[model samples]
Target: MKVCSVSVDLDPISCYYGIHGLGEPPAPLAHVVLQRALPRFAEIFQRRGIHATFFVVGSDLASDPSGRATLTDLAKSGHELGNHTHHHRYDFARLSAEEIEREVADAHQVIAQAQGSPPIGFRAPGYDMSARVLRVLESQGYQYDSSLFSSWPYYFAKAGVMGVMSLLGRRSHSVLGDPRALTAPVDPYRPGSGPFRRGQSSLVELPIAVSPFLRLPVIGNWLLVAPARVRTRLLESVRSRSFFNLELHGADLLDADQDGIPTQLISKQHDLRIPLKDKQRAFEAMLDRIAQDYRFAPLREVATDVQREGKLRAGGQNL
Candidate 1:
């Protein structure tokens, strides 16, 4: 079966601020994503019958009533709310193990409070995680982690972006992760011993999708900015894989003009510069294409199914 998993990193504008290396965005940008764009994302998934997994920053729910309410509504409407850490720390790789544990625990507590259940999955901020991070997840009883993006093309592009920003005097707060990720497996595997090498940690790693041919990404930010021909070809190539683990962000749907975001800030984001209507059409079309060719499931569900497949293969059953 061709399985598909859709997810959104519901990072607040503060997270984006870190990416842009800016001090802080206007207050409106903070609430706009959770309070404004979330419902719209939910509606799109609902209409298309796609069960999206939302990786929410735990700290975002700490004191905001409206934000918590909107997240709670997502749970009520059957979306799987996963943890994206408490602070959305960009330097998650550099944090001490104790701090990492605290980050995960704090986020877990807050998310569990809102959804009435602890999230079973996690995605590291900035797609940077380490062995210590995976250990904390195992200790916390998480079923899976989806932070390893091993596409060489994606890595080079990210490096170039940060490099350009550095030269332009706009030092981005985003950290380039472990270079070894470029060699990690592109499919689901266990991350017990290390994030890059397969081990016995009991936690599955569902890497984001990349084209098998050239490692072109199938992520939302790339999709929104990529040309139509490139997007179509990449999607088709990814569909050839057994699992299509598509990742997105709340900012992917927000428009610079209507969202009240700082022009300077959003200008750095390629996708946000596109007209909101055009973004919607492109996104919907992409989803429609996936819905036609693959069965859309949340990461939690897809992870479970992948686990089963692994077990069956170990049992000598041909997949």
Candidate 2:
């Protein structure tokens, strides 16, 4: 079984950098990572003989020509390039259908211009999405969306509905009121037949990997917050799962001492103050471990593989 699929969310906005405690606008740390850390990340992956997807923000491509060139280089280096969003907006759940379409379309255009092809995969900022968001993604020609995580692979719909409801504060005894509620598979499962069919839609949903601990999602951010021994146990637990989807941010690998934002946001999630060197060391350690046990693939490749396998199991033509 594949134990992990590594992905990076590259959000380049000053607000994102600030909120994450990387720095204020024109985050110097962010620029450094784009220029320095990303190349190192690519080198690490290449040395390990693995490839991971990079979900880039459209605005980042527009604002930073060098960053765009670097992404194109990554693609040339055999890594997958994907779209995060144009503005990296957090309120996708509140946006209207038309608005969602425009945002996705605009981002698609920018990514295509930079990479010389439209992105085949997308990840909504904050994993915030709605049914309309899915509709637009499918219509806009995205092949996969990695924005939702299901605790259990087999019973993902029910589990994801419960998890999403709790997060959105719309949980009720009688009905699932979360606007993001949909019966799409929570892992790398195929959509239904037809354009609007829940299971047969053209797009595949590849949610982040969550651990089975207390039925909660176990992802990278959570791993960062866990104690050393506990994190070890969680990683062991992840190796036992059917599939492991690990995520990282470009900023996560950068040092705080670098010219950039303040230290509050980086330290916000954890009580202990993690210095830049330590952060880089921790990330390198995680990459080393993943390199040993997993065969990393881009999100689009994974989804396509899953779809083909599912079809084979059902005695249907390969997708």
Query: 110-161 in candidate 2: lDDT tens per residue?
Result: 8888777779998887665566777788888887888764444324544465
For all predicted structures, in order, the TM-scores are 0.94, 0.78
Candidate 1 has what TM-score?
0.94
Query: What global local distance difference test value does model 2 have?
Result: 0.64
Native-vs-model 1 lDDT?
Answer: 0.84
- Which residues of candidate 2, in runs, are more than 4 Å off? 1-3, 17-33, 150-186, 191-198, 264-272, 311-319
Candidate 2, poorest ten consecutive residues by summed lDDT: 172-181
| Candidate number with greatest TM-score | 1
lDDT of 1 by residue, 1-319 (tens): 5777899999988878788788887775677788777877888998987788999888888867898988888887778989999998899877999999999999999999888788999999989989889889999999989999888887888899999989989878899999988888888887657899777777788889988857778899898889999889888887656678899999888877887778777667767789889988998999998878778778888667656666322222122
* Deviating ranges (above 4 Å) for candidate 1: 308-319
Error of 1 at 217 (Å): 1.1
